[model samples]
Target: MNVPGDGGKYAWRTEIRTRRLAVPREEREREAEALAEGVAALNAHKWVCAYMPVGAEPGSIAMLDALRAVGARVLLPITAAAGPLLWAEYTDRDSLQRARFGLLEPTGATLPAAAIGWAELVLVPAMAVDRRGVRLGRGAGYYDRTLTAAREDARLVAVVRDEELVERLPEEPHDQRMGWAMTPFGGLRRLGGTEAEESSSAG
Candidate 1:
């Protein structure tokens, strides 16, 4: 559902990015740990497509480990030219190396973009996600293009901080809505009114 006039995409991006940057280092770490625990609690999925959160992003190395602890095959994204994102298997923390945009990618074999369809769960990076499931990325269309290949039954989850989940955001025709969101305080929230409970749980 598109909500008119929630601010332009760029402006909303700037505002949310500023808030994320303002988070203290210690707070971020604590939140990352909480997020890891939350993800670990959901052990149903076998293959999960996720990202290595960099800089002030909401996750940590521990989050990936938590997913792996559940015996899931984790797939990380490998940045490519202006097109759909490539994929690589994440063996461990040691397999990661710095890539473009200061992102960390796996050193394993790079898979084609269509490989995303193999995932049962996809944890997407976002600056913020609204109650209606609109995700605000870093103004890049990587996920927007890459997510098209995800299996229709695959759970599309946006990972964001507790406060970053808001009421609404600017949306575009190409912007995909996430089915769920993982947060520090809220474990797994079904967005777009699938579950209307107030996300006030503790982290």
Candidate 2:
């Protein structure tokens, strides 16, 4: 499967990464805090699948803690052998340990890839996402591969900064589309895909 790593996609990634690196430490922390509060307000979900932001990623550890405080049992992804991602329960900040691919994962029981099906919401990290729900990942295709097992009703939300949410993005058929976008400022914006269509046509 072709990941977004060449040509237009590669250029798009470079631009987003550059912008992300330019974010000051103070602003990042502030946005992260706001993200925590925003994510916590998503109380409809009890079991959530989320990722820990590393390096210049917009979110901080507080995001996961906020999810936990909302009585949601959060499941963090663990990088496994070259394939779909594995899963582990996020008990707390201390339970996370540095792991392969520069990721911090839970040092607890590893669950099967299908464990993601148990989640009502799946929060995925992205460089950028468009209004149409197209997400630009880190050229790994990890989420694309793992999301195949996500329950049909599960809300796939792309976690990105407010500015990172744009008008359009390059999308492939194999790429998993997001139903919502979670940003520090916007909190959660419904994307312009089937979800939006359904919602609009309903009322």
Candidate 3:
């Protein structure tokens, strides 16, 4: 169910993001361990789109490995001249390179957007998120643009530390909330579950 909003939601979301930037290093590591374990069990898909990690976000490296270890096809982002985002098949680590942003992307042969729907899962990156599947990104709108073409039933999951999933996040018409928040300590949190929980868990 989509969580209804009133006032103070945006404020809460902002606070959650701030908290993560300030979370103790030890706590962050524990969260990472939980996330890696959970991802290892989701071995029921053929294709996946996941992050390659940059900074404090729950790094997608673990998820990428699980996907590949299960022989699932994986895809990563590619910077194209035509747009702010693009998709390419994951070939090999040697073919990947660091982009202008700290993100690592595929540099092998580019894949058409038409080939995007082939994936059954999309593990996204976000600064913070709410349950409505509308993610609060780094203000880039990169996933917002490309995810529009993802398969309707394909899971759009944002892996974050428990502190990154907020009770109520700022939402605009163009933003997309993820289906679930995969946090480190808390397991799977269905977005917008309850304010008290979202706040305290992420807080």
Candidate 4:
């Protein structure tokens, strides 16, 4: 599977190693808090898609819990067609499953990808991303396909570590860029790729 790499697979490996080496619990917590606030703010009004945190990934537990506290119906991703994703309503963590690609997923019945049309917000996962909103995911491009079906007004935020929000990235026309990068401490910034742009040819 081809993916966006700094230059080569080795470079990406190096970057991942560095990120893992330097990320202490303190830094991770700070980034998670900042991300939670930004994510919660954008998701305050509607249904939101949340993902289970993977290795070294920032947790949406805080933000998701907050949304739940406010009586919002939270949703989780269920695999769909290649390079795309689907979702299902989930009220808690109990419905999750350990799945393909080592991703933790929710096993509930699937809702239409079009269901996102009613969503006010969606939080995505990323291995790395850019200030321009270009995300370097695990190469499946699942969110890319899902974003294609999301509501035009839906706020798409990608949860990542602060350092992953860098200068730029490689993007394909089908790739999805988020509007915000909810980091652990750096808060939020208007990112580059948008639902419109992704829908356009600019992705």
Name the top TM-score candidate. Answer: 1
lDDT of 4 by residue, 1-203 (tens): 22345554356545754665678988777766766665555535657777767767777467667677776788877775464567787776676678866676767788877777777877788877776777777666577777888877777777777667667666678787787666666665566655344321112
lDDT of candidates 1 onward, in order: 0.86, 0.87, 0.69, 0.69
lDDT of 4: 0.69
Q: Write one digit per residue (lDDT tens) for candidate 1, span 1-203.
A: 22235578877777777777888989988999999998888755778999999778899889899989989999999999789999999989899999998999999999999999999899999988988999999887999999999999988989998888888787899998998888987788888874556343312
Cα lDDT tens digits, model 3, 1-203, are: 13334534455445555666787878767776667666666646888877777766775465666677777788887756554466777766776788866778878777776556888877888876766655777666677778778899977788877656655566788777687777776666556555444421321
> Ranking by TM-score, best first?
1, 2, 3, 4
Worst 10 residues of 4 by lDDT: 194-203
Clash-forming residue pairs, model 2: none
Q: How close is candidate 4 to the true structure, as a TM-score?
A: 0.78
What TM-score does candidate 3 get on C-alpha atoms? 0.78
Q: 183-202, model 2: which lDDT tens digit per residue?
A: 89877878875544423110
- Each prediction's TM-score versus the true structure: 0.92, 0.91, 0.78, 0.78
Model 2 earns a TM-score of 0.91
**After aligning candidate 2 to the native by TM-score, how far in Å is the CA of 44 from where it should be?**
3.8
